[model samples]
Target: MKISYHSPHEPNCSICKKQCRFYDSLREHLIGPLPKAECAKQFSERGCSLCLKVFPTAQQLNNHRAACQSLPPLPAISGLRPSLVNKRNQAEKEQILEESSNKSNISGIAMDCEMVGGGRDGSLDLCARVCLVDEEEKVIFHCYVRPPIPITDYRYDVSGIKPEHLMGGMPLKQVQEKIQQILYNGEAIWRIRLKGGKAKVLVGHDLDHDLQCLGLEYPTHLIRDTAKYIPLLKSNKTSNSLNYLTQSFLGYKIQNGTHDPYEDCVAAMRIYKKMRNEDHSLSATEFVPENGVYSRMRQKELEKMSPEALLQISQSDFYCWCMDSR
Candidate 1:
């Protein structure tokens, strides 16, 4: 007698949901033991084989592939081109000089420029006027710079330069030069005096950037940055804000509306004077230069010598010391 073996539920093709001859065959198809020829053909017809998403045309599929493999476009070469680079540089230099010349009348002006951002890409947009005071602490020069870059952030509201002010403002190069001239001229006057007597210092908080922004080179020895003297803030703390330092040292809070450059410059100078005064009062010690290998060997030999021999060598060195001092 013949017997039929059948599952109570008929097994169907996994890909198409069509009934198959045997459960084993259906299992093999579903488990992918044997490749589905029709499914493979269907996948080949569509552009995306993995997802089987079809595109209208082969060109669209090729275009998508090209896009996936393509790289981003690079920035336009600003300085390398023969046509535009030199002209741009000359324009920038002239603009800087013009601004500096315009602000020449202001005595000891302390100016700060606010830019759209901090990095190289960001352009200067606002200027904070700082009028330098005399020894009595009176304002001598004050004026805000209207920036050219559009202000996108509301945080600049405290900077006291409105959008209306910047709408018809000058280029940043001009403003930067103006600030530089004010600072450098103030420092230069004292430097010239020091040439006949003692060196005068250009004092500032994080002044390197300020000097750099102005396109001026300052002697490292003559310049003093307040940010450097306070070791605790340099090593331990993250923030070195002028506001925090001024409040801590001067016992006065910087006003919230706009940063006064004059006040900042004064604070920096005060800090520098304090440090210098402390330095001058310290006792001096003789500094010995490291001797050559032969000298070092001689030193070791001297160390091994008897007390009488060492004393004799010391006496001989007295003549050498006198010659060196002369």
Candidate 2:
């Protein structure tokens, strides 16, 4: 998706180029405040949309793209998972087992869940389907889950899950066990002593909700949530929707039709990988804080640190699972 840049009146950061409200200035032109050091680093190395080449100057990018060959479009992805549970069998189970078995040393896997309402008012979320994908975008596990409570709302329009779909769905406990097995690489969670362990990172958007609905818990350090990633947030410092982040950052559209957990999983993984590829480049002397208290520090304390040091100690406005991972 292309960003609209028709308005020159709108203020934008000189370094990061993100449009935002401007502060009063006598010069009538200040390109807004200087962006955080990390943001400056990112904008300086931005890739050209037309040619996929990184250029230091917008003029250079434009000139290069004018004569550059366009890259081929990626093929459409499909067969992510079945809409019905009857289609699942031993073959599918074996495929998941094989994939999980191979991930003992892998860095992380992405996950997404579809939920149905089950409370009296059909207001409580319950996990109905789950999808997990590896770094290569291969499906590690995907299955429909039976909610423990009777589903008051199948949320057919949103989730595409009907009553028939859950008839043969895996029990909630079984689904939870399978997901835990895949995430933990079959090692018991309690036995994993270190932050760096057999446990693989879990990538997703709004993962707390997904894990809550699924009734599963994972180490904070092992979760990468796109919605809470600091640099990916909107100008207002609010979390962006997964669909917006996918189209705006990853150059694709998803979740337009009835929600597909696998598609969402892939999108979340792509965003996380994109962020992971950045050169944050903090020095060993610049320590990252644990309890996320940097933002609450007094202005005097903040002013004492250099911009790079500030960036090092800064935390996401929201609870980013990636924080613990760092």
Q: Rate the local accuracy (lDDT) of all candidates.
A: 0.41, 0.65
lDDT of 1 by residue, 204-229 (tens): 67766765544446556555555554
lDDT of 1 at 162: 45
My TM-score estimates for the predictions, one after another, are: 0.42, 0.69
Clashes of each: 1, 0
The number of the candidate with the highest TM-score is: 2
lDDT of 2 by residue, 157-234 (tens): 789887877777889898888888887777777777555457787889999999988888888867788777654666
Best by lDDT: 2
